[model samples]
Target: MSDNGTNTTDATAYDYSLYYSEDTSFFTPCNELDLKAFASVFLPALYSMVFVLGFLGNGLVVCVLVKHRNQTNLTDMCLFNLAVSDLLFALTMPFYAHYSAVSRWTFGEFMCRFISGCHHTGFFSSIFFMIVMTLDRYMVIMHTHKVARYRTLRAGLTLSAFVWLLSLCVSLPLMIFTEVSGDLYGLVCIYAPDNRAWKFYNVFVTNMLGLLLPLVVMVGCYSKIIPRLVNMKTAKKHRVVKLIVSIVVVFFIFWAPFNISIFLQFMQREGHLPNECKFYRDIKLAITVTETFAYTHCCLNPIIYAFVGQKFMKRALQMLSKWVPRIHFPPSRDLSEISFRRSSVTSKSSDITSTIMM
Candidate 1:
């Protein structure tokens, strides 16, 4: 058992610390030299690449969205919030990259808590916004006239604020418990509460809020939407259906493995799985690989959620042309002409605007 009566050691309990020194007394110190060496090289390089791509992509989305803030609909607002979440998430990559490469937390206690808080806040916020967007699409498509008045700019803003608040609430425990303390190695930033219950809470929150809840919501919403789209005769409906499918599939593909790995570790702690050395090493490796895939989703969000939309791409090019006068972009199609008109749906549904419907 751990010092806190948990089966998890410092590094195993939470994934924040990438490497552990073998001198730990809380558990049998497993020599992880091979894993440490691999992470030192692998994590820094991949994290740097992700930071560059995710920052640029999400940054462009923010610029375009802010420029068109007045014209934004509920969907656009959700997309904007999503971009902000990804940017927040991306900003933490460099810190973690440095931590992994050097195998220590040199940034101090404040940053350790702050970065951990930001990382979880961004994660939950991003997922929550995606859920919000999904439900928004469902309401606009399925409920139509019933939700029309409530889908206004003010409502979107209110909902966005709520999501951020909830995300912060969920992340608060992790932030409070996270500290820069001396491990067997140098100082490491980790969730190191004395109570083992907090460890369970950490994993429970991650599994339930981050994965299970979102998965259920997406599945429920999309199941209703698919059949509705199938019955519709418009080509626009067909395209919207495809985008919806892509959103759901991509999310699970990138996130499911990571969540599953966390869950398995939780189960092992609960004595539901074998707690052997090989299992420990294997699970750690799985978490590392799967987490990398999950991180890349921030980079993909711009393409999946915004760039796929013709109107968004046009606006982006227009913005680009303005910022770089030397390079010319083709004149975009007339906004009035390109705006999608949903057939046979209520006028409120038609109000969804081409800003989001790809």
Candidate 2:
């Protein structure tokens, strides 16, 4: 004011500007309202859909296989057990949905442990069964002559028991680690420990044992199987191979990304990476959605199996025939017979019968 030299005595107090170098953490206020709305609406809907579909799908597969008593073969028994594990897992989804919708865990500590234990149990069981299935397929196709003796009902039952025991062992950590905790938002069921080590332990164990190893086995088995399938000239064999390939493809497509995302989340949580990154958050959300879809594959299999299983379409038609009014439908020719007729200029009756049988 003195330097400006107009009226130093009555100079007004200068209004100085205050500048803030924004802290990244303080940039975005925790939008509690948005989070609550998301939890109340979208989470519940997602969980409900996954739960209902997974339960029905897995249940139907188990019922159909068990009722027919057609799952005596080791491979078939393994598939049946896989369905059972998936159904059990599906059972817990409603509880999760309820918690998410309410934005709190009204269930007690015991239930929190139980639910978490069941989730791991199902997951490990599913992985074990899938691995067994892949191994069985490999043996059946590549070493059929030598491995035929091991495909008995007794062997199947023993293997299934071992898988169950292994799964139970894997789930033991859940019983020990899972707990219910209260925060400003609500009571959250979380894995609480003194240090972050257990979180890393859980993530590594699940990613390696539950996902990576099994995936490697599946891929290895299929790689060898594909060449054998290609060389087979018979239509029936080719169809069966194609069906199995489709199942493998679907499994990989639905699960690979989900598991990868889960691994990343684990890394983020352990301070190996920053969790506040927007990209990470988006990936986490995507993983949650994708995992839900992947879980639905457990239900999708029965539909696939019904279509591809031996004589399933015929049996389904027979069942339909009982409900519908009798109408004259044209007799369906065997696909093999049609193919033989088209390929061979001189079509012998014996050739037609052989092709039909094949």
Task: Output the number of the TM-score-best candidate.
Answer: 1
Clashing pairs in 2: none
For candidate 2, write residues 1-358 as lDDT tens digits.
0122111110000000000001123123323354355546866687788788888777766665675565356656877798888887788888877876776678888888888778778877987888888787777666757887877998989999999999998777655666665544556566544455655666666678866788789789878866765565545556656666776778778777767776765555445775465744454456546666666766676665553554434444444455554854333445455655554423332222221122
Q: 1-358, model 1: which lDDT tens digit per residue?
A: 1233221333433335846532233224466878888888888888888899999999999999999988888888899999999999999999999998998789988998899999989989999998898888788778877988998888988999999999999989888888776655677787766687887888888888888888899999889988877775544666777887888889889989988987886676567887577786787788777888889999999999999887888999999998999999888776565335434453333344232373
lDDT (CA) for every model shown?
Answer: 0.79, 0.61
Worst lDDT run of 10 residues, candidate 1, spans: 1-10
Model 1 reaches what TM-score against the true structure? 0.90
The Cα error of candidate 2 at residue 213, in Å, is 1.6
Best by lDDT: 1
Deviating ranges (above 4 Å) for candidate 1: 1-15, 21-29, 328-331, 338-358
Please give the distance, in angstroms, between residue 124's alpha carbon in candidate 1 and its true position after superposition: 0.5
Q: Estimate each model's TM-score.
A: 0.90, 0.77
